[model samples]
Target: MDDEVTTPDGLRLAVVQRGDRSGPTVVAVHGYPDDRHVWDGVADVLAGSGHHVVTYDVRGHGRSDSPPGRAGYDLELLAADLRAVCDAVSPDRPVHLLAHDWGGCQAWHAVTGDALAGRVASLTSISGPCLDHVGLFLRRRSPRDLPAVLRQALHSWYTLAFRLPVLPELLWRSGTLPGALVRRERVPRPSTRDGLRGLELYRRNMARGLGRPEPRHTGVPVQVLVPLRDAYVTPALAVSATTFADDVAVRYLPGGHWVVRQRPELVARCVAEHVAAAEGDPGTEAPALRRARARGAALAAEGGRAGPASRWSGALAVVTGAGSGIGRATAQELADRGARVVVVDLDPAGAAETAGAIARRHGRHRAVAEILDVADDAAVAALATRVATEHGVPDLVVNNAGIAVAGPFADTGADEWRRIVDVNLWGVVHGCRHFGELMRSHGEGGHLVNVASAAAYLPSRVLPAYSTTKAAVLMLSECLRAELADDGIGVTALCPGFVNTPITTHARFAGADDAEQETRRRAAAAAYTRRGYSPERVARRLLRAVEKNLPLAPVTAEAHAGLLASRLSPTLTRALARVEPR
Candidate 1:
């Protein structure tokens, strides 16, 4: 059940209760520009499973009171609201606190503040960091007051262009963008659009205050979650907060800005591990970290994989978004090398074709394709249950359903924008949340394959949101890589450069369906189509990256070149990039 509590400062806060009141209570503080609903994934896991979870809108965001203007938007005020929520919700209990983004900053403040200091048994900070170094997030904040509002009106051409007077009017009234963003991140997706008004609040006040500083002064056991590719909070920034405390433990997972929505189970497991530790249960062991590097070294020593390799030969493998491209290639590759493949896709016909082809070549039953949409939460959960029951717990799971998006940030319609994010990015998240839990419980270590892009590493002006989502995917994958490493689950990030796929057709263009754009993409992909390797080439690279336990995998010579340019000679890459007319 859920209800709203007014903060002492007169802000309305939403608090959700799960299980009995006596259970461990976790106050989850979500970051800037987002509401309490940000914690829905983590909240559900805790509540439905018996722990007590409380979530609330933070000042300007979500369903909470926005007040009249910027007068209420400041660091101290934001931190104060968090304390008020805790006081109102679980004043007596030794609460477990989980925070992400801005909430992480507030949690840092709470741990340091005189009020609730030492009251928290354990804390988890996700994709946020110490306040001082949060220049990355700060650089993007909106200025205070009317000037700030005007700044959004001016510099935020992307947001303005997305809906404009017409589309924006419709989206705001219909609440499509906010609702879709929320629904995309939630497991089986959340129902209410309560605090969703905060997206505009965030856009208007892009200038959210700095996050909590490092907890060096606090002695509470801590868990810090960092997404290596986060656009707002860099991993370095997240790591800086750890230096403040001695009891720091870290878990990194895959996905971006809103990872909890996509991979709730992964977040749930890690959060549960921390809470269980605070409650004094035997801790989730960390074996993979100590030995993953050595294992990768051993595989390299043995020369490439001979079949399924020792790590996953007998393991059940579930590959989703497998109708074509890397998904299709990976599924068939696994079957050819002898791992049973469960080919999953939203397109049943495409999936069946892939499955039938696999059958004819491998002699009947080597692979099976099931039609499904991962964005649909119930569908994902059902798939997880069915796979566990039919194929047994899959030792390997791949989140690969992705579509291509191309266009200037402006003209892409809301539905176009929402669908790309839901499928390409969030789909993997849903799979990880549901399937990851199933694999973890089976007691057999499993591997997760998330298909992020080379785009994950950099922000592209042309494909603003698409690039933004990939960056999130990269970070989310990296976070999972770190956390699951100890669990003997090797996480591989398939970060590919441009490959020939149908992603081109779906590319959201600015003007008409101009022939020029198609011609350009064709010419660019022609480079690959010429000496081009099949998607199987990428699949092979992916398998090798997994066996080698590489933290990141780039798929093309162009990708390797870009890495050298981005890392070794930034100016050269910039100059070369500008060599072509924009």
Candidate 2:
């Protein structure tokens, strides 16, 4: 339905409502240079989910009546308009607020002040920070924060341009501004009138709000969606809302400034999750939302013993082969960062030892042990379901379980080849398949790290079976990375060389007698010991790879050199593969 909401200032704002009238109300407010139509895509999705979605144009935009002068565009007046609309729409119930850009600024003002006290249930702000919060953030900046401040200042350059007398208005009127937005942000063509009148928002509020900002606080739950690629707002500035709000969650999304238009389904999913979290039973809050709580508040609630805050705090991670070597080290590293880790290994003693060590350092709740053979698809799928039901979906998954095989290709029988491929290749495949789907269904992004080897790319004669399996894993990781990009999941292939680990002791050597196999194993182990590389180093690189979302991470000096050589000269690599070890 379409109607006119008359604000106390005598301006008539155009309002549109959709979805079931009996459902909980969600009021969506659009940013500058956009009208109620900016929320069309989001509203449709929310409406389908049974939310009474409402969208409206603020004063001086769309069908709304323009104020007589710039003085009428004060922040207080904008807050009052929000109050008048909420009172007219649903006076009995507290409505959830979803806002973008300038609309978020107004919503922040309303919720922070008494204008909408007890009237707003929750607030979801996208690409917009409260002017007062931004002011306080700048006022409290230190030397270490100079880079962040500078980045934000560069983003706000257009805010300064808007302060100019008539240049901004001319740009909008000439279609230059709208054209730029379409080309740069991929947003639909915006109306010139909305662009022209919205300038008052900057002129009337920017200086006063940021220069002498008030101590604004809100008791309402707030979710700040920080778009990593936002052109107008830096993620640091966008997340500053955590400073003032009592209950706040900051979620980092992958998109530009106009993410609402670019990824409406994603925006809607996040908004709905926040709204449900606000309205549902507190005990049943989503794990992602719980982890996203402001660092200070979460730490204080936990009795201030969670150690220093980290990006991985409260995250859940699953690592296979966590009994020894790189897998155990990675599990411990994640736990040190405040993540709850699930340590899975075929050996019960190894898994228990890893988990026990983590528990000793970070409390008993920090880690759990599970026995699993990764080659079994059914078992892995069952584990994925159980983990989701009992511990929530994992935010990070590391598939590091594998066996090694050595000796000539001709001597490697079908059974030996099958055994190595089952553990090395199929194990990674099962982890990615089950857990990747769970992450996609949850609508929140996660990371996957698959452990390959330098043998994946470097030609090898003595390690033909091992090289083939590792190569297949590397190719699988690359393909999955491309396929899962749109779903927000990251896939990384970790290739390490000559790490001092127990794999050498267990490797099977084809065509060799039992005694000869044992001798070769001792020789290989001694050579690796001489190289002096540690699994802990590979663990650190794995974390960095996930953090940066790197497609392929080559650890150890030899791994890097081998990768370069294989890519630069195929003939030389092949010739080197023919040399027999002494």
Candidate 3:
């Protein structure tokens, strides 16, 4: 239904409503110089999800009539306009609110003040900050927070220009500015009248709101979406609003200021999750939403704490073979860096135990476990799907699951060859193919680590089958590294020479009977133990490789030597490989 709403100031505002009226009402407010049509992509998604979606042009923009003077565009009147929209759409019940840019500024004022405090159920703000909050943020500046303030000041250069008298209107009406906005900012072609009139928003509110800040507080559950790559609004400015709101959650998405247009489905899903949680439907809510509510409740319960930020604070990672040894150590290492971990293994018990340990060490919900056989393509695809649903796309993925088959190639049975290839070679393939797709679709840069071995480059006559599988993994990683580079996804092949892990204990010895196999396994395990390397040490190198986006990372001393010798002194290395180890 398309209708008109008269604000308190007697301004005729255009309102467009869609979806079932009986469903949860969601009112979306557009930013400066942007009409309600900017939300067309997002509104369709929310409507399809069974929410009653509403989008209205702010006064002085779109089909809405502009008020007479600059004072009419103040936060007070803008807040009133928002209140009127809410009253007309869902007068009986509170409506969920979503806003971007200047609309977010006014919505914040409305929710924090008495304008529509109790009338708004939940709030989701994207690429916008409360003007009063920004003032307070700039005022209480510590040495550490100064850099963020300065960075934000740089991103807001246009705001300062917008405040100028004649030049602002001249640029908006000249027809050159709109073309420049499209070419430079990638913004959709804006209406000339909308741009000319919307300038009053900044002129009327910028100095007044920030010049004298207020103690704005709210009980509403607020979700702040920060666009990481926004040109006009820095993430720091958007997330700083969390300091003012008691019950607030902050989420980071990979996009520019016009993220809704680029990733509408993601934005819609996030809004739906927030609305569902507000309605007490926790079944479909994301883990992040649940955690956010719990955190906000805790902050309100027991005053907030000031803690330094960590690299892994908001990051998510998935580690295969995390049940034991190198995989377990890697998962723990990533968690220590502040990342939430998804611990996966072929063994259910091992995966659960590892996940439990991580959860206990960090927070109970920081780590999750999943039982998966990487060799099963369908199973791995399902795991990828589940992880994306439960948690957002993983920032780091470690394909570390592998097995060992030792002895002469001729003596190795066909079944043993197949088993080793399936677990080691095909498993890496499955993880890369499935998880890689998730990372690409996310549009955010991520890293993939494939655990190869020094044996990949080191020729071994006795360990032919094992070496072959490792070598294949190395090549696959190299190929993926080149292919996924443009997508901002990095691929690294980790080659650790010989670490003290349980692989030796489970390794099968070909040409030997069962009893002899047991004897050989023990001997091999002893030799690896004598090498005195730790899985933890190898794990550190793996993290470093991801941090630097290294294509080939050789972990141990022997690994480095093996890689160099294989390239420089191939004849000598091959001669040494021909001699069987005792």
Candidate 3 lDDT over residue span 29-124, tens digit each: 999889999899999999988999999999999989889888889898999999999999999999999999888898998999989967988999
Q: Quote the positional error of residue 524 for candidate 2 in Å.
A: 2.7
Which scores better on TM-score, 2 or 3?
A: 2
**Cα error, candidate 3, residue 178 (Å):** 2.1
Local accuracy of candidate 2 as per-residue lDDT tens digits, 450-539: 999999998888999999999999999999999988767899999999999999998899999999999999998999899999998888
CA error at residue 516 for candidate 2, angstroms: 2.3
lDDT tens digits, residues 470-552, model 1? 77788888898787764556677778787766555445554446787677567555654675657888888888887677877
Error of 2 at 108 (Å): 1.6
Model 3: residues >4 Å from true position, as ranges? 138-143, 281-284, 291-317, 333-342, 347-349, 352-371, 382-396, 404-420, 436-448, 453-498, 506-533, 537-582
**Model 1 ranges with Cα > 4 A deviation:** 1-312, 514-528, 570-582
Index of the highest-TM-score prediction: 2
lDDT, model 1, position 448: 86
Q: What is the TM-score of each candidate against the true structure?
A: 0.46, 0.91, 0.81
| Best-fitting candidate, scored by lDDT | 2
